[model samples]
Target: MRHIQRIHINVKSFICPNCAKSFKDNDTLQTHIKYIHECERNFCCRECEKTFVSSSDLNRHTQMVHMNLRRFLCSTCGKTFHTSSNAKRHFDEVCGKKEKKNGNS
Candidate 1:
């Protein structure tokens, strides 16, 4: 007879000391600390000389501003957006039937 052993894998979490924000990985936690707490902008845009906290933000800026790429489009209003979230926001705020309270809408 042979004996079999099982191993358990735990979900590793990294916590921020300042704001108590949690992350799944150490690299993500470090990045959050560097960008949010430390205010480090290592990524720079060559076109407009703007600094960004991450490369993804710089790439988004370049695509939207320099490349003029509007990938997300609103079906109702025929408006275009660079990101999906913005289009969704427009739909919720402008197009959706949800009532506006406190003069916000």
Candidate 2:
């Protein structure tokens, strides 16, 4: 004899009253409200008209275009990477003989 259990997953939904746009994630919905309805462009690029939500994102964009530096480097294969995690991923995929996080070899 076996008992079967049914699991129900609740899908979260959000509705934007101002713009009539809906989203599943609260963070995205908040961002939409702040940027679209309020028109609050707090994060502005010094060199261009592009704006972002955080300073770290703007810093990364500046480093990528203005500094022209590849911060991450693969020690195993001597290959340059843009970010440290990407370097680790390349090492794992190429030399360490490990499958990617997606589990596809």
* Top candidate when judged by lDDT against the true structure: 1
Residue-level lDDT tens digits of model 2 in 13-100: 6678797787766777898888788765567778875887678878887787667678888765678877888788778778566435
- Candidate 2 lDDT score relative to the true structure: 0.70
lDDT of each: 0.80, 0.70
Against the true structure, candidate 1 reaches a TM-score of: 0.53
How far residue 31's Cα lies from its native spot in candidate 2, in Å, is 5.3
Tens digit per residue, CA lDDT, model 1, 1-105:
111211133443579998998776677889888879999788999999999987999998999999999999988678999989999999888766433543435
Q: What TM-score does candidate 2 reach? A: 0.51
Q: Candidate 2: where is the Cα deviation over 4 Å?
A: 1-10, 15-28, 35-39, 98-105
Q: How close is every model to the real structure, measured as TM-score?
A: 0.53, 0.51
User: In model 1, which runs have C-alpha deviations exceeding 4 angstroms?
Assistant: 1-31, 98-105
